[model samples]
Target: MPEGQVITVTGPRPVSALGVVDAHDHLLIDSPGMPGQGFADVALSTVEARDGVASGITTLVEMTPIGLGRNPAGLRAISKHSGLAIIAASGFHRDAHYPAGSWVYDAPVELLRDRIVTDLTRGMHPADWHDPSLPLDEARAGAIKGGASYHHISHAERRRLEAIGAASAATGAAVLVHTEIGTAAHEIVDLLEAAGATTDRIALAHLDRNPDWELHAEVAARGVTLEYDTIGRTKYHPDSVVLDLIERVAAAGHLDRIVLGLDLGARSYLRAYDGGPGMRYLMTAFVPRLRRRLGDDAVARILIANPARLYAMPVAGGAASPG
Candidate 1:
């Protein structure tokens, strides 16, 4: 809101201060139900932060949204311990991530918005959110994380999406949408925009998994940020694939709308848990390759400038106009 201001775990700071940001990633994530998908850095300790900071990221966004082990206190500790600015997520994840009889089943959209806004403006409740007796942590959220379905958004998911839109509009926080393997990205943007979230502050995550350069161009043309994570996940594809996709979108004049992150939420991904590539792989491995291929300008945009713009909140009383 202030000149070049962006939200961080340490509170507001100038965008210039947030150097080499990992646009999307997780810290202190302890999600259950995904038996095959656990990670080494569940608590996001000083050790993980040391390696991650050594690798290159100045700011790493934690994307484990509310009700799913979204540890705000842990995020603040990691940022302080690692000396890396960490931004936390508020809002909801994929529908399958929640239980059938959970709050999503009966909580009205307005209630969802209220809770999200409270977390963003005030402080986050403990990750074990089902218990009302637990106290809220002082650390606040910086962004709203929303998830869409694989191909089409389900009705339950729509409620979350609408609530995310309402919360973002009310608080001026960025709406980070998780597009499952990049499916239904356009529709996700349309839905958020229709519900009062401005396209300028909306970001779509994991689009690189889809590899549709044309689709990226189309989405970016409409004013939303494209977050192409999956940087070092070789199983998804070679790093060259993501590099090529970035180059294509850059050539199409959508570079400003492009951001980068490593959504390493699994135990197999973090080196701290004996995983292959750690959180800092982007700065340590990918950036060197990116520099050799796309040069420094590309490196700066994907790692720094773009992330700052995408994460910055709009000024209060100066609401962003819907496009």
Candidate 2:
């Protein structure tokens, strides 16, 4: 298999630079069980592929292949075209979010683990992806993902948790978990730790929605990075709430254990409250303001260093330039 040009992992490659890396973002993810052309954004705009870089985001990790219905060929083409270090993912979203019995939930835990290991070691395929000639491990994917649902935890949630845990133990790929709204945060953390996964490589997404200071503190203390993904203050939680959570985490002195991503998808319309166009909160508003308030060093730790460290991507180069 031919490898694409090796750009600096963080931002675009430079002789001496550590690029700006988005710890998590869904550049291509759409509704589950749907094809790429069927997705609203993919159908409507070519902008979807390069939006992250255009928005001053240099590197991005697309959340899941299943949800986006992405094609590896298309993903590679997009990455080549955009010049962004586009890290991709394998594994399923929560059972309820997509098909109930999909790979993440219904498959026997060990099988799912093997599939994830294979994808990580190799690469993933869409429903039609069946090429015997391709190398699986060198497929250029980054992490394994699993989710807890939006409103409530389902009966089958534990199975997904166990599957994620097993996959993490089997392969050292990072785990990106979507926790249930409000109450399921600590339970997910305990589940992963109990399953013998290390806290350093695990990231718990959507913590701003729950707003539990103690849980945030505990997870951060354990060296697990918390993702405050609800960047555009539309749809779910308030902007103030999001800011409060960040402040709380910073005050707890766990600033190094935080990662930022918008969590926007191709299908989901931008909510009215979303600091529209350009993801203003992240680039225009949040980064500048946080730099002013927290100082340059703190901002770097929260936004840049923390994410690079959390993802375990290389960071030996110099400071990353603004996108």
TM-score of each: 0.93, 0.79
Model 1 lDDT at residue 122? 67
**TM-score, prediction 2:** 0.79
Q: For each candidate in turn, give its C-alpha RMSD to the true structure in angstroms.
A: 3.0, 6.8
Checking candidate 1 for backbone clashes, the offending pairs are: 38-267, 39-266, 39-267, 40-267
Candidate 2 residue spans exceeding 4 A from truth: 1-18, 33-46, 49-51, 65-68, 100-105, 128-138, 150-155, 266-281, 313-323
Predicted candidate 2 versus true structure: per-residue lDDT over 1-323, tens digit per residue: 11112222222233213356666666454565444423433322235535556656666666754444655555565667766666677665666556654444455766555665555544555431234355443244556676777655565666666766776665555678877663566677677777666787688887777888778998889878888877665668656677777778889988888888776654443322222433334766567756666787877676666666555422222112211
Off by over 4 Å in 1: 39-44, 316-323
lDDT of 1 at 105: 52
Model 1 Cα lDDT, one tens digit per residue, 1-323: 12457767678777778888888987666665466665434344567777888877778888888767776766777777778888888889878777778886578998788778877776777764676567877777788899987998999899889989988888788999999899999889888887889998899999999999998999999999999898998998999999899889999999888888888877677777777688878888888988988789778877888888888777642233321
